[model samples]
Target: MFQFLKRDPVKKLRKAYDAKLEEAMHAQRNGDIRGYAMLTSEAEALWQQIEQLEKK
Candidate 1:
């Protein structure tokens, strides 16, 4: 039954991206511009890393 399973390397990265995006949005609501920007940057970096993994 487990034969259909496949490794999803990008899944964790996508989850991290989503989490960071939410953090950024929450920080924005709190008027923490610096924190929001940092989280957004982190999310973008994670996405880039995930994209790069496809080249391997």
Candidate 2:
């Protein structure tokens, strides 16, 4: 009955994903290609996790 009190994993992952993407954008704009790529990859991994959770 307290389901509403439980935090949603997907939502948390999505928030992290968005933050990663934003950080990646800043990295790219700052001419840090390597950092941007790394951040993008991390964001992709988070996306995959979100997808898996959604599938469940």
| Per-model TM-score on C-alpha atoms | 0.80, 0.97
**lDDT of all the models against the reference?**
0.91, 0.99
lDDT of 1 at 20: 95
In candidate 1, stretches whose alpha carbon ends up further than 4 angstroms from where it belongs are 1-6
Cα-based lDDT at residue 14, candidate 1: 85
> Taking the tens digit of each residue's C-alpha lDDT, what string does model 1 give over 2-44?
8559768788888889999999999999999999999999999
Which portions of model 2 show Cα errors greater than 4 Å?
none
RMSD per prediction, one decimal? 2.4, 0.4
- Candidate 1 to native Cα RMSD, angstroms: 2.4
Clashing pairs in 1: none
